[model samples]
Target chain A: MKRRNLFIFAVLAALGSGPANAACSFSNEVPIKVLSAAFEAWKSVTDAMAECGNVQASLDQDFRLKQSAAFAANPALYQLGGVANNTIPQLLNEKRIRPLNDLVEKYGQHLKPNQLIKVGGDIVAIAMMVNTQEFAYRKDIFDELGLDVPKTYDQVFEAAEKIRQSGKVDYPLGGMTMSGWNMALEWLNVYASLAGDSFLNADGTPNFNNENGIKALELLKRASEYMDPEYLVSDSTFVQQQMQQGKIAMANIWASRAGAADNEAESKVVGKIYTAASPLAAEDARPVAMLFWDGIVIPRNISDEAAEAAFRVAMEGLDTEMVQAHNDDAVWLIEGYKPGRLAEGAVATASAQPSPISYPMTIEMGLIHSAIGNQISGFFTGAKSAEAALRAAEEEYGTAAREAGLLQ
Target chain B: MRFRTFAAFVAPSLLLMVLFIAAPLTSVFVQSFFVTQPQIQRVETERCTAGFLEQQCTTEIKNVPVLDENGAVVTTTRFVGLDNYRAVVRPDRAFAALSAWDWQALMSIDFWKALRFTLTFTLVTLPLVVGLGLAIALAVNNTMRSIRGPVIFVSLLPFIVTPVIGALSIRWLFVGDGILTRAMEAWSGTEIAMFAQGWTIELLMLFYRVWHVAPFAFVIFYAGLQTMNRETLEAAMVDGASRFERLRYVIVPHLMPLIVFVSLIHLMDAYRVFEEVVGFRSQAHVISLQWLTYDLLQPDDAGNRAVSRASASAMLTMIGIVILLVPLLRKSWRDHKGAR
Candidate 1:
């Protein structure tokens, strides 16, 4: 009787393993490695890819810092990399990523037309999702205070004032104001909304040191007054937690985090949060946001066989089946993705009159972004005036640009 | 010992020091004087990215690195003497701010700001660590033997924890609505935010460094206390010396060498304060020289890092540590010569 029972258990274990292999249409033979950002969408995609076997995915928040150097190795450390608009330039400029036109033509029958990221008329990356910062707020509190959904910065400030007076939450506003990359992105969003597509001159020198720059700085300072006093340490996750815990009433948070509001396990105020298009900095300008896309790229240093295998596995990961299972994970560009209610803010912002600009994929923009991140905190800390902070950022950008050989 | 034995004993460690420490230091010193940059060219290119419902294409002139025939970025290494250092120190801006009597402007510069905090953090915590450590050693010395072990264990717990983890633990204890902060708020009947300002964060960092390191000082001082000359202490006692008088005249004099040793170690460690800035996430409010170097080395989104500037900052940090140790080294040298 015991031997029969053991034999039956072994049979059951074999049955359990059968479907795991059957889920992927093809059995992968190559040992492929992928490096990507650690996020919900990447997790879903990579897990789907793992079904094909021999795929090792490293999900790290610091993937950008490693991607370029890893891809530049004689035999690339990773066969595939996940990148966004801002992170793809270094790989492109170094000629480290291969053009995927032939691979796409062979195996990308299911890929959408808009999914191909082309530079110099050659497909380089296959975008999976679109992301942007949008206006997220606690709808319950807004209705309780009889406040309308804010469309412009002034209306947002007025609504924030009303919420503050009502004593409904700990703070009337939350922001990704942590003093490095987050703060720099916040500055760019506001600056671009006020002065569109003028980040640099034709010669790659900074061009945001005039009236629009000061106004953007002043607006950020104003917004900080309605936020928590510890705003300088508040990153996206912190602000997301603040919203989920019902501590903050409103924030211009990432669209990727909107699903967390309804996560019953962690959120205290489930279904109480809502999102809308990002508020405009001016009447006629676009929303105060920038569009970003997360995608996969094949590395040039890998052998053609590895690249082909990696691309096929990537396609399997990004198939309609994955999107159907993880529809709300991101604003997926895949065909089967059904944009849920949480995607409304991102969709509305993207389709608005005078839609927001995609983040620049240029070498000079990277230096400028770092310079702004390093120096802009002084304006809010009361250490420097807005003009002085802008001047300092320009000077910092100049130094870095010169070092990078973008400036003489 | 025979000369051959001495050579065998010393050779391995000396070789390791040269291979690990001296080689890297020389590389960094050389790197600080030179700049390696990719050759860049301006080009007009059309790029397309995914939009929500469609694709957005734009044409712009971008600065892109020139790639060689073999698909590697072409780079040029040049000896740019003092340029990286000048970029970091910015003497022109510093002198301008100084001459104008603009303290805020001077502090806005990264190097000067980091230096001010690093110096204060090092100097302020040194005496406190020594004092607290000495006090604990004296208390532990007078305690009953049975309780001494547990007391010492409890005191050494903070030191046993990893430095970054210890800082993070303290941060959680006080960060936003943490239990300690909530209790303090209840006690004071007012709201408090510990990380809302620069000085409060600096104060917390100093407190944490003292708390974490005083146990190390305590263990060393406790060891020194066991070898204390009982006769000298008894002589002071019979001479009608009060407890304070004995401690001042006999006990402190005997512990002076140990104090200097701990001071030298603490100064070297404290001058490179980095974990607290990261664990506390106080980059916006305050920064240290070590953190500044790390920041320069960290790659941005576009994979750009100021490697030469980072090396320069590292060299400056080492120079600072050497200057701080000069006085202590001089005293130790004098004492050694006198003994000889």
Candidate 2:
């Protein structure tokens, strides 16, 4: 009788292990097409999904803009696609993506409630990750210099200057000021926090030509002094390289790229980099970091059956098991996500700042973002004054707004 | 052959041309006259009464667009002929700025900025490309036969490269700690950002266009050299005409037709100028007419494309191309008439 009981226990344990191993797998019935950004987190998740069934993912470096055009032109080409938070309003306004409420009710029982992106009472997207620009620094260098983490933009400048004077590094600050979209975003991140409201006024006019705008531009220019001389061409990748190669002491970069600091293959200063919330502009102002969420959406033009299958695959891809396995790949918004070793810095960074604000998603806001990129180069190159740049930005935005039919 | 037989022989080519070229052009022309309106739908909202702890709100679903007659959604394309054209040209704003003598403001407009760059890029690069191509062709033509093959092969490499790839290669050489950039910095003891300002970026773009495109002109000029009259060259030489004089009076006149051909192709190709902007990432400083059209086609925050504006820009670019080519086309027509 004891032998029989032992055999029964063994059989039950084996059966239990089998289900857990194959739990997420489904039949390869329908082919699901996905368009996503070419990032490690997305790659790992998509690789997991591809194990379950038939999936073809087109991962691109510029997937956000490309997917928008793809969905607009031929939505049927993809059953599901990933888009950034700032792009959501436009896709929603165009009615290109379907409400995912029914799919959520059916297959999204495991999805977190906060991850459901609702627009006007309709569930449109299921967010997979939370992305934000956070402040990063060399902890070892800061400790060596007997410095504390900066809490405001002024403090950051002081820290950068101290580091520069110490003769420890060539430039203490690295920037993402590649003109056009990158530079525009920097202006927005600084000014939006200083303005403490929407980019536009209540009456839908351009509103960044005041004191706040000039101050933001001045602060940006001041920060440029301690940065690499080629900061105008510097982008996120350039900043990341600077940190990894120990060329700079601190920068506010996307949290998604923070993992590279600890990557032994790419980093010369491994285990030395730390992260904290982005610096503030003033005592009363908010954090200067820009908040963005990237998630998956199903275009409306595909068949319902296809949509259902695509959602199932995406859900399994974003399931708890996958998140746990690839937790360091991103700051996940899924269940079973505990801050990994690398994310400790990111968590500290986030907690130190004031509550974050979402990047503006209005069409008018997009127009302004582009207009600022076009006009701010003048100021950077000394072809225009701070006030002149602000005026030009406002005028350019006004013209774009009028052309987009957002203004008369 | 009978007229009917001759017509039958030309019918297929004409049909293909009409289907492929004329139809798309016509569609673009018509699309410029119409605009797509965004679809607006009513959404429910809630109002709450103020209270100490929390406001108790009652939800009421209302059809926002349905109730307001003037706010009705536009369901069909509307024809606003010439509106898109006006937006592309911005004539009123330009005129006002010009009246005020605000030259800066007038050039600040997107259309004017793009047009200025496009025109400058095309007109400035035209002569350099022609001169360089003719020079290379003359050099290769007079070379020893044994070395001619290798020289020709090596010279055609630049032209053989894809345009975007060539531009990117050149950009990488001079951008941010790149080999050439570092070398220059080391030598000059000063930093250089080649893509920083408008003039520098424009100069780099001009250099890249000449480098990448001169080889095509070289091959054409070289091939034209093979068919030149050796007897005329001998006569010019016997008359004690120098090599430069021989080239100026004999070879150039002979290569004029090919020069015209290459210039026409280059003008049309360079006037559009899309790939260089993309490869160099110069949209912050330099933009072309074709790039403006592409920028318009990009969907805005509403996911709605500016189709009418793109169409209008495209039409304007085509008009610019036609204007630039008018002299050459007229010369060709006159030459053909003289030949008859």
Candidate 3:
């Protein structure tokens, strides 16, 4: 089987300008679980890894649940899996995935120093790509309206109001405030940047019901008014569709989804969409964005031999050859990744911001997110006041924290 | 049969029940009385960069039950009796809210919120499911024999569809700019966002529940209708009873047992609602007790689960089901006794 795969790989390499120095080879089989959206990128790596080893990729958007369940139920079922940045903290704390420091030193010669996911003093995962939410707008509409690129949330509102009054677009903005998880992340993005480093204080008590919390809630509610009437149901796809159909002029959406805006088949306003850094909440505030890394983790319960094979396959998949081949699909962390036409906006967005902080991966942050996801929508719908919403959020967070033993 | 033979014959089923049902139920009950929280320990390590003379140390908090030779946690689960129940029920908070007459705040607790929706969903959908099911059963029964088979098949289609799919299909029809949504907008000349608010979502969920579940009741009633006494129905007609009166007095009385059966089944099923919340993505506005338990069992950001809380929620839901089933069980028991 190994010889057959190597033969197939050599033929494919001959057919395409495959990696000339494809030296790594293995006989073991490795099964990978990853998000379906990143399948194209994974496909390149899997195919490349096939030359040396048997590699299988299981594509699922519910990778978090799958990874956790697989590790809990039967870790040997999979050898390698990917997890989002926000999910890393849980995976690390649970010790479901073993420390990759030894493996990295042994097998990751081509890996960059910055790509290592260090929790405490040990490397646990190696990030393949970076993803974050950023400002995306219709450049043509901005030019026609003579609107300057919005640098602050106030400017964004002004532009939205002008666009709304001009009747150029049905909705001036798009939002991903779908009631639960997405909305929670949206609140986190705005609050964490505007309010400061953390939602909890040093002692892990609830601390978001302050002036900053109220302001963030008010800003969210105000910004929501300019979005689709069904903003509460609007997720990334809905907002993307709104942009595609020319219903909205601008949005803060994931950089990973920016390429979809220019897909001519699904878009009416193709080439009109442009991406930039997220609008600031205050004059000197951090950009209202959260950086996320998509990385692979090998469960600790898997056989050492399997883990080694999985690590080797993963490294081969994330090598320079694979990155250059599928760089357009994501903002790659690998070396030799040149930003393509589709990635130009995300590149500009990332470079423009002062290195956005990752979404905090602590359990308290997750609980705080649950609070925001559950209660903050009340403020948006006028069911509760901003102050009341903030208070409710704090109350929920406190209860959850105490219950989870994160606080006294 | 001899007593020993009877016991031997029943032993397998009893053993199976003890292993599968009784054991898990007992475990969940036991788990409800306990709570599991992260076990943390602080460790100090000295750092000497150049020499031992200039040494510094730092202390860090670690999640551990007991540290191994390599400082890895060997065990993390810690048991706290009754704390899981306390956390979910929050007796102190509930009392505070009640004493203060803060009804809104009282409903803010997750358990209370989920319980409110679960009860509302079950109670509201119960009668509608029964009535609609009976109505459809009668309509199909009255149809000509040639079309009866096809009519019954069409009536069964809703129940035949997967529950999640059925709920999702209904949800999409009413969600933003869906076909029905657009039609409503056009007819009313006003935009509608059916999923934006809790009440609207609840109404939609109730409607979906009826649409999806009524067929089961209908099939049962229709089968019962076939076994109705023809002579009694004819006698009722000859005695000048109207169609409504015949249905009310004769048919309903005859089908009371089947109606009870359907009600018992619906109560048990509806009280444990989970799929609809997920299908409609309505957790933002509405949640059910089963969903709450499932949500608790979900891995936190640290990969560990709220197992004790989930177990407590399961126990509470089971108790609710048992409470709802008591009267029906009592009625059946009385019927059995009277029949004997």
**Backbone clash total, candidate 2:** 3
Model 2, docking class? incorrect
TM-score of model 2, chain A?
Answer: 0.91
- For model 2, what is the alpha-carbon lDDT of residue B34? 83
Candidate 2 deviant stretches above 4 angstroms: A1-30, A61-79, A94-110, A299-309, A340-353, A361-363, A386-405, B39-76, B96-103
C-alpha RMSD between model 3 and the true structure: 5.1
Ranking by TM-score: 1, 3, 2
lDDT of 2 by residue, B1-340 (tens): 9999999999999999999999999999999898765433445554222111122233533222122343223444778889889877889889998899987776667788899999999999999999999999988988999999999999989988999998899889988668999899999999887876678889999999999899999999999999999999999999999989998999999988899999999999999899899888887677888989988787654354578889999999999999999999999889889989
| lDDT scores in order | 0.91, 0.78, 0.76
lDDT of 3 by residue, A238-288 (tens): 888888999999998887777787787899988888777788888877778
Please tell me which model should have the higher TM-score, number 1 or number 3.
Answer: 1
What is the fnat of model 1 with respect to the true interface contacts? 0.83
Q: In terms of lDDT, which candidate is strongest?
A: 1
**Model 3: clashing residue pairs?**
A26-A52, A90-B301, A90-B302
Sort the predicted structures by DockQ, highest score first: 1, 3, 2
